[model samples]
Target: MDFGPFLLLASLEGLVQAAVLSLTALGLCLTFGVMRVVNVSHGEFYMLGAVIAWWAASILGPKYALSGYLIALFLAPCIVGLLALASERFVLRSLNYEPEATIVATIGILYIIQQTVLMSFGPDAKPVNPPFYFRIDFPWFGYSGYKLFVIGAAIVVLSGTWYVLARTRVGLIMRATQLDRDMAQAFGIPIKRVYAYVFAAGAMYAALAAVLIVPIRQAHYLMGADPLLMSFIVVIIGGLGSVRGAIVAAVLIGMSDGIISMFFSPTLAKMVSTLLVALVLVFRPQGLFGVKTS
Candidate 1:
């Protein structure tokens, strides 16, 4: 195959990665942007989604694998989201949403989730069958149809998220809360409830990303680590609270990662990503899309 075709394939692969990363980072950004709480355990929620999907698929796969996988696709995130909502009400709310304290609390949550999954799911990596299988033929190669599905699904979910945030009253309430929690509360915005919803929504996004990618990558208890790191890098480079920035940055980073991994090595790709993040931090502390806060 010519280098041009190779590059094209690499870019497609990158798009898939970027799509998943964008959703994951958006969740992180929403939590921080709106609630000012850095969820250290965010990746665990991603892992939890995959684990739950694996469980759901396993139970249902025996009878109707496709239907089971489809059910898991929707059910896993809801389970993870509800768990997150409960955690926020019980753990974070009790802490009064203090940033530093929430960090510690989420760390505890991270360990708790990881260990629980380890005990229940065991340490082995588990794979889920894709709902359907096909390939897109190219001049020199073919790409995964399922991966394309992931990218398309991400676009749809992201669009729905945008509509919710931009066109709906809930979005208005969340935005108002993000801007000034005290004032929003004074205006009867139910800041505490908003915080709970945002936190759960953030977790739901991460879980959705996990469900989308679990078919490509097997579910493992430790799988959350890299996604967490990549998500943090994306959020930081894109601007901590900017959804547009997160999506843009995810594309840039994901493409670079795919191309670099194809041509060089994944380690090198990660190194380059880390270097890019450092450069962005040094030059643009507020991030590409983040606004300066006083």
Candidate 2:
């Protein structure tokens, strides 16, 4: 077996995975950092995004002679955000300041979403093909143009998020809220509205990541499981609410998964990744960039 080409493909796949993981982790960080809720059901939200995108592309894109793919890309995240708003307003709002209860509620939400999708679309996988197939070949590597596009789009979204959170007034309020909800409320910040916005924004990011991943993994009801695990490991290693930590951990995890899968079995690769996450948590429970929690 030729090692050169194999390594190149693995590198490309790793880059793509890293980008997806980072975007998803960013969403987790935003929610965890701001709401202090351990949302274990975020993976289901990602799956919803992918499935919604696939259905929209199939139903609306072709019949009206429109760009089904583009429509999916735009609409799926919005739908996810709307769902997040509904969930936060109704369920999560009731569980405010109750982290354990919020976590349990999110888990319930996850199963509900999974079963709902299964009932609506059945358990079969759905394919979302790109509009065009073009590869930009280079001396070092060659990969699907669509995959490259996914990476590019993820980068753009992550960068835009960073800009918003770091530069804008809303972002300042978000950060202020994350630092201390009670304090922010005392200082005239609309704490409830901030929570809603953060939840919606994080949901939007998760949905967007799922939409981008469809071309790579296809769509299925249970597709959220693995990514959800990966995202949790990332958030844990990076630290809650630390976007930089998430990115760094995502790259490490992505590269580890990619290189290991190339040489070993998928099952072994996952086992090793889980072990690594455990070790990280044992030593640094707060995560690499996480603030110390009382």
Candidate 3:
């Protein structure tokens, strides 16, 4: 392929990556920003989503591709959300959400989930059949229609999330809680309930991202590490609790990954991203969009 065509294709791939990363990192940011909790197991939830999606594919069969995908699209997030809710209730809540302790607790959860999946699902990567497939033939090249759908879906989900956080009463309460937990509680916001739901919401975001990406990347036991690391990088570069920032950072990182990987290698792309993060940390520790506190 010519350089122009290659670059165009790379950019499209990067946009897709950004879309998925936005959802995953946004979830991480929400948990950290609102609940002040670090969920080391967040990536596990993503892995679980992909695994469940593969199960959905298995049950429904290739003949029912679209149906299977739709079922997994809705079902996986719900299941992951429930698991997140339960973990928040039983583990984080009992530990009082102390930063250091919750970190340790979630790490334990990560290992448990990883090992369980390893034992049950085995170590092989499972490919998922996309719900439907069509190719958009450009003059220079072709692209997957499903990937474009993913980009649109990401836009819709991000917009809805923004509306809820910025416009709705539910959002108002959550923001109030995020801004001032003691005051919100004094005003009758159920702090425990909010944290539980928020945690679940975060996990659901990760799961949703996984569902969207599973067909492309397939399901694997150890796939969570990259998403988890990139999410933390996104959160750091974008500014904690800044939805807009997270989206922007995801695009920046995702696009860079795509373009660099096209010309050189994926590993080099990651190294460049990490270097960007290091520079950001040194120059703006609060993140590109985060607020500085006294």
Name every residue pair that clashes in candidate 3.
Answer: none
CA lDDT of every candidate = 0.90, 0.85, 0.92
Write candidate 3's Cα lDDT for 92-162 as tens digits. 99999999999999999999998999999999999999899999999998899999999999999999999
Candidate 2 Cα deviation (angstroms), residue 156: 0.7
Model 1 segments more than 4 A misplaced: none
Predicted structure with the largest TM-score when compared to the true one: 3
Can you write out model 1's per-residue Cα lDDT over 232-263, one digit (the tens) per residue? 89999888888788888888888888878999
Give TM-scores for every candidate, taking all chains together and pairing residue i with residue i.
Answer: 0.96, 0.94, 0.97
Model 2 error, position 80 (Å): 0.9
How should the candidates be ordered by lDDT, best one leading? 3, 1, 2
Q: Please say which candidate is ahead in TM-score: 1 or 2.
A: 1
What is candidate 2's lDDT per residue for 1-294, written digit by digit as tens?
368878878878888888898888888888888988777778888999999878977786545423777787789888999998999999999887498899889989999999999999889999876756789886666668988888898889878888988999988998898888889999999998888888888888888888888877889999988888999999999986777788888888887788778788989999877897898799889887777889
Global fold similarity of model 2 (TM-score):
0.94
